[model samples]
Target chain A: MKYYNWGIIGLGEIATSFTNSFQQENSQITAVASRTLSKAVAFANEHDIPKAYGSFEALLADQAIDIVYIAVPNRQHIEHILKALAAGKHVLCEKAITMNSAELTQAMTLAEEKGLILAEAMTIFNMPLYQELRSQIDSNRFGKLKMIQAPFGSYKEPDPSNRFFNPDLAGGALLDIGTYAVSFARWFFTSQPKVIASVMQPFSTGVDEQSATILQNDVQEMATVSLSFQAKMPKQGVVAFEDAYIVINEYPRADEAKIFFNDGTVETIVSGDSTQALNYEITNMIKMIEGETSNRSLFLTKDVIDLLDQMQQNWTN
Target chain B: MKYYNWGIIGLGEIATSFTNSFQQENSQITAVASRTLSKAVAFANEHDIPKAYGSFEALLADQAIDIVYIAVPNRQHIEHILKALAAGKHVLCEKAITMNSAELTQAMTLAEEKGLILAEAMTIFNMPLYQELRSQIDSNRFGKLKMIQAPFGSYKEPDPSNRFFNPDLAGGALLDIGTYAVSFARWFFTSQPKVIASVMQPFSTGVDEQSATILQNDVQEMATVSLSFQAKMPKQGVVAFEDAYIVINEYPRADEAKIFFNDGTVETIVSGDSTQALNYEITNMIKMIEGETSNRSLFLTKDVIDLLDQMQQNWTN
Candidate 1:
């Protein structure tokens, strides 16, 4: 059995969630790092990690860490990923992979030169349930796909101090929740659609509080997506085909899904474990590090990056 | 008192909702019309309407019917409203007043020549809750107005036979629910903003199932909106200002609203009656007919029509 030692480069909420998930999976969190030594020490102690570093650079220097998970804010993703790649460590970076595709391209090039595995940590893209959904579509079970709608949002009391609504942190609904919806649209469609229309609400900090986007391909196939930080939502995505429809209950990172056929038959697929999707991404990264695969699926990562770039350019906040 | 007797041009579901709402108010339904006399007569008997006509033309021919409410499908709205105006009757048409603004301009010109009230029946625009929300923003109670997020959708089994998804009838989210969200954004901002981004999904009948939109004005204020028919959604809109937020529980004619101030004071304003917004429009029209007001609120009606027209032009459906 092959196992890779993992190091997390941030001690934020997401990073903690990933660490807890990894612990449940019997994966090793070899080290943890944060800007503050006390925070890093507390997290490391809480997670029973073997090492804690005072700074990101120190964590990158740890030779035993085979892979690094970059869970920093959006603006810092590229910088941290490039640093980890230069250090000869495999990298799994969070969504909105970089500030834009230009940065993504630069990181991809650097990773290729270093012969290091670099994957955008979009766990939903590799989920068994999503794969099954794609299989069903590929098999033409739903007939010709016509439309897709997904909305993910939540009401968070405005706190200027939170990274989510901070403009300097590249924070907003689009870069955050919208990225998930847009990525799903791009993944299923496999083409860049023109943004035919859009409406957005900018927060006081010049970041989007909520946004709705309408994208269409040359053939007029369309997808509508909504993301917000202004209301409570039951995360969902529905794909309507000519003969049937697929309803994803908890979309973007759905664990269970159902396909409703025109013939009145229902097919259900449930991902057995309720584990966070980060576990799957991290597990995949370890496999790649052990020479199990050539590189993270280029098509999926490119799709995410391209979609993010287009969305960021399309939206000012 | 110039009590202009009203003729309803369609006995559809929306027409029924409107009539039910009007029954609670002072408005009188003088006549009801449908293509089938049996259907019109049944509706008249059920609602206690005074007159039933077999055809729309018959209703128009009746010299006693002073005004006409065109509640037909979107594609027929232009034809019916134009004919009603041409028949020397004041017109209060449904939202998406016409297929496009060009038709609106033509109708407005005709109404002007005839010295009649040609108002788009946008109930939300006439609602007391919306007016209160506007007042809060105007008074800077919520500080500098920033963003508005609203979504309205429902999950209903898609039947190709239904008018909602039928492209031939100009049915889609944009013309249906999208019109409400889009119009609300424009109304709140009080300006026509350029569409910064958009995404849409087409239905089996070549109509939009869902649409997400983002818009930004020259002043840098933005509004985000989402509209769909593919999922069940809570009816709501959140208007976020710099220092406070107003939460509207039932949007598109909210029955009640809560305003939360930064100082921790929450004020709940109950909406007038459970009546649909159309009654408010009917009341306004009645007042206009009585010569209480010189002309229709052109700014409100024009802004709404212009917004819907611009959004439709970008339709991917």
Candidate 2:
């Protein structure tokens, strides 16, 4: 087994939860970096990480760190990923990999040229239940797939200081909750949609607080995704076929799925433990870094970003 | 108690189901009509109706009938509704009142001019559970409402002979499944949506098999509705507020609701009996005809039709 040493950049709230993935034997959070030395030291001590760096560059220069997990704000993702790549570190950046398709392409191209594994840490793509659903769809378990529906929402107050409501931080529903819903559509369809139509309710920050999008491919496969920061949503994802449908509740970290057939029979599927939902993606990233497998998440991340970009463009036009 | 004697205009599948609402006291299906004499006779005999007419005109000519329920093809709804109004019969037409908003207006105007109780026979609008949910929403049981989502789908084989795929029959997902979803949005919002966006996948017969729509009002309140004839959907609806949400399954005839709050407490609400879900709407129609209450379903029906019409126009342009 190849051991993976992780150095984390930007210690935020999500970074704290992300440490759960390092609770395994082969993976360890060796270092953590924050702009404030005190914050870095506190995080390292709390998480049992060995090294704490006061600056991101100092953490990048640590030769013992084989990988860097960037947990910064959306605007800084590209910068941090590029800097880490320059330092020859494989990367697992957070979702909304870049602001637009062009930026995502630039970062992905550089990673490819350097022969480094660059992946987005979108946990849904790595969930065992999601994978099983994908396999079942491919094997025609539900007959011909016809439609998919995914909705995600969270009641975030309109506090201007919060990154979610700040336009300058690339904060909005689309880049955050919307990405997961769109990613599910892309993964299930395996083709870029022929048409995309969307509408949004803009916030005072000029970012969308609520938006609905429709994606339809040439094969007649369709997906409807609704994203909001104004409501408490269940975040359920559904994939429907001519004969049956599969529903994944809280799909981003999905552990359970329920399938209902046309014949009135119901089947429930449970996969990995819910608390360890992030472990599969971390292991997948390690495999990508070890050259045992290419990063499939990279391609899906690009598709999702491209679609969101096109949707926004369509809305404006 | 006032008795309502219903006259049916068409002997179709929906007409059979509509008769279920008459199972309660103070409501009776006294007469029915079909173009074919044998069908009319067979249907009336099967349902134990007192009279059967070989032609729609004969049914309308029946003086004892207090109201006529139009269950003809969608394209024929406007024509049939007008004729019933002209005959001075209060009317309860099946959903999708007309081909478009213009036709709906014409039909509703005639109903108003005749002082008849004209309404869309949408079961969800009258379901007891839906009424309770609406009351709870008004009472702020879930706090301020922010979003509403209703998705309905079914696996309809694209048989050319079937009305579901016949453009001449005004057949499509919109007129069929989409109506319920759209009506729910209109009922909750109580205002014409300022924005409507949609995308559709058409069948080989040139009728839409699936559609996704987004409707938003001025208060930033929004609803996303998805309808399909290509898949088997769970037909659940959700109303989300700042602090809680209510979920209704089998929404068209919903008898149960589950309320989930942010505090991890869940409340399950059961209203009318599931088997008699249609009775509430039938009673409401009777009340409407008795002049006890004006038909609220008419106004909402018009709003929904207008929104669907605008979405199609937007798509084509």
Candidate 3:
């Protein structure tokens, strides 16, 4: 059994969570890096990692690191990803992979040319509960699907200095919580929506604070998604069919789902390792590193990027 | 105490329910009319109404009627309302009162000219719980209002001959369940929205089967509404604020409301006569007829119709 060595770029909060997921696995955080040497050393001590570097490029240069996980600011992902790929490292970047599809396409082309796997760390696709729901939907278990409603939001005070309200960092609801709902809709449909309509309101700091979107396919299947930095929600996704409907709460790391039938009874299905949801993605990343790609089936990073781009265009126009 | 007599223009299912709401009131259904004499006679006999007319004209001509409750098809509302005003009777019409704002303007103008009350029987505005919510919102009980999400939908098999799928009757999800959500948004904002974005998917019968809309006002207050004829929903409305939020289930006839604050304690408020939700509308209609205009506050019948029209236009474009 081959162990996968990992290097993390940008010692952010998400990077710590991703490193923690490797505790019981065939992967280890071999190296970590930050903009300053002291912070990188502190993070390395915190995680008990082998190496610490003062910059992302120094971390990428470590030949023992098979994959580099980028958890930097949203607008900087593409640049860091390209640098990691150039240093012959497989990359697993955080969600909202890049600013737009054009940049994503360029990064994907680089990864393809280098024969390296590039994936977005969207844990929902690795969730067992979401997988089961998709399988049931594909097998006509819920009958004719009609509509889907997904909402993800949180109330954040609009501070001008916070990254969430900073326009220079590409901070907005669509790039944060909105991406999950958009990806869920695309996965459920398994096809690009024919129509995308959206409206966005700006925060006081000039970033898109809240957005609502509607996606419809040729068969009249509809999906409604609402995301905001102005409210906190229960974080549920509802998929409706002719005879029954399914509601999945905490959809991003969904562990349980309920099916409400027209007959007035509800069937609940519980799955997914909630405490270790990130482990699934880590394991899949290892599998891809070993040339076994089956676990990467529903990796819709590019499609989600495209959909968000379309929705933003719709909102702006 | 003088009793008010009602003349129903269309003896359909809604008319039956409206008449049922008068069980404990200062009003009585004196006459009923339908396009066919047998149906009108059967409905009148079934409801214990005194007089049955074969045509709407006959019901409108009855001088014994103090008001004409027009529960006819959407396309016929304006015509019947005008005729009722001409016959000197107060008009209480079912929602989606007219095809467009122009028609509604003509009807309201005629009612004002004749000194008659022309009200749309939108039950949400009359429900005590909804009124309480508006008052709380007005007084900033929930803090600075951020976003509102309201959804109403039900699975209805598309029978082309059914009124729900018929274009001649001006039928669609927008005119049916969407109207309530639109009215709710309008009533909450108290100001017209600056942007209305929407998407609609048509049924096989060429009427809009599902619609999702986002309405945003000048202060960045946003409202999202979804309606469908092909899905079942929980029929809930969420009003989000800076420090707290409230969820209203069965919002049109809401009897229970839950307020969740940031301090992790939830406060639930239960009010309104659920069993007689429709009676509130009847009671208010009676008050409007008896010169008490306070109950008519937030009578945004024209505004809601205009918003729906704008949303439909946005969906088409």
Candidate 4:
């Protein structure tokens, strides 16, 4: 099997978590970059990464890195992903993919021109548990799918300096956690629902502290999602059907899930967390580079980016 | 002081709770009515009400009853309130005062013509706790209000037969619990905020099981609210100001609440709950009839009903 060397941008909490998960999965972290040299050096030392570079440019210039995972803030994802695509490296970008879909399309054009694989790191999509749930629904085990309800939120002190609460950082609950819930709804429902109405609370720093979104598709299929940074919430997803229901515990963040049927039958699907979804995308990119596939089919990273952009524009307008 | 003898329409859970509370507050439940004479007789006998009627029309036609509390389902609120208003009795309707706001307006106009008080039973507005919190915010104790977040949800089995999951009954989170959260936001902000965005999940019966809403005023003040019948949630409200936050426990429902300040100070405010907020309106109606006031102001029933109408239209559109 061919191995893909990875370069990571942005040495933040998520970056560290991805690095640790990648290492545990036996994936190579070939290079690491940060805005500051000292921080990069410290992260490299802690993670046993082969190379640490102070500048993104230097890391992009390196020929050994086969894939670059853009783990930076929302605004930076576009620039960094474009640069990585320009440098002939497959790119795995974080969620919200870009500040908007237009930026995402620009990056996609560049990636397409270079014959490079570009995917968004939406971890839940690649999990075996979700796949199994999808299969069950497709098989009509839960009868006709009716609704999906999910809430992903936490009670955290408001800190304007943090990227999660900084408007300039493209921060808000919708772009952060809401993406997961919305994506799950779209993925399960297999259609983009119209944003029917919304209510949001802006923090002191002008970022959404909590948001409630309601969407409905042409078939009248509806999904309700709540994302918050101001309260404690159950990190779960519920799929309600005509005959039965599927409950995903810690969905969008859980590797394993339980399925409940209308007949009082319960089945637990355990998909070991073998890799942080970022690393899985890296593996997929390696497969694509080795002539297996050309683009992402399940997530359609570009389409998701477009959908997010549309949602944000709708909210702002 | 002049006292108003009260008649209750629909002797269900809410009506029983209201009459029980009213009795404790020195209010008289002189008449009770339901579609079934047995139900009304049973309720009246249990509560020591002097009169039990088989139908709502009979109760409304009674000249001795000065006020009527319409505690029927959402679809029936308008009909019952209008009937009571047409009978020249003051009416205190339950939340989501009508199936939509148009019905509320018609009832309000009829009440005005009859010179009768037509108010909504939004007991939270009458609670001393909310009043105290409002006073603190008005006094600039928490600085300028920036955000408001509240999530109110409960987990229940999805049985199409249940009123909460039955579309024919106008069942949905938005019309039920969501209205409370929306009303709380409007009450706090005291302005009509645009519904920026919304997402919802419809139950098998075609009613919304869960809904998330975001609203923003022209000044950019925002509030996010989530309502669900699919999960358990903290029935509380959080008001984030420029310098501090006031956290209210079990807001929009409970009489007593704990307020948490940003500076780590905590205080508790307790208010009368004998009538589940129904007695407060009853007391106010008596005062109004006695020339103490010409109309209800504490709850601003008109504004709330209007807001609900606008929000429901926004969702449908």
DockQ of every candidate structure: 0.16, 0.72, 0.61, 0.14
Deviation in angstroms for B62 in model 3?
Answer: 2.7
User: For candidate 1, what is the DockQ-based docking class?
Assistant: incorrect
Q: Give per-residue CA lDDT, model 3, range A26-46, as digits (tens).
A: 778899999999999999998
1 or 3: which has the higher TM-score?
3
TM-score of each: 0.73, 0.95, 0.94, 0.71
Which tens-of-lDDT digit does each residue in A1-317 have in candidate 1?
55678899988989988887774243588999999999999999998988999999999999988889999888999889989999999898887788777888899899889988888787666666776777777897766655666666666678766878898888788778877787777667646676665566677888888766667777555676666676544466766665666677667667788876656688887873546677777766766766776563555667666665666576543
At residue A90, give the lDDT of candidate 2. 91
Measured by TM-score, the strongest candidate is: 2
Candidate 4 local Cα displacement, residue B1, angstroms: 4.9
* lDDT tens digits, residue span B1-317, model 3: 56999899987788888888776457788999999999999998998999999999888878899988889888988888888998999888888788888898998888889988888888777888887777877897777777778888887877887889899878788898888888777777757774466878788788898888778888878888888888787787887787788888888877888998866779988778777876777788778777775535435877788888888788777
Worst 10 residues of 1 chain A by lDDT: A230-239
Error at B67, model 2, angstroms: 1.5
lDDT head-to-head 1 vs 3, winner: 3
Give the Å shift of residue A7 in candidate 2. Answer: 1.3
Query: Residue B232 deviation, candidate 4, in Å?
Result: 9.9
User: What pairs collide in candidate 2?
Assistant: none
**Model 2 - which docking category?**
medium
- Residue-level lDDT of model 1, residues B1-317, one tens digit each, is 65568899988888998888784244588999999999999999999999999999999999998999999887898888888988999998887787877887888899889988887777677777777677767786665555666666655468777778777878787777776777677667746677665556677887777666667677655566666676544456766555666677667777787876655678887866546577777887777777886553555667666766666666633
Docking class of 4: incorrect
TM-score chain B for all models.
0.92, 0.95, 0.95, 0.91
* Top DockQ prediction, candidate number: 2
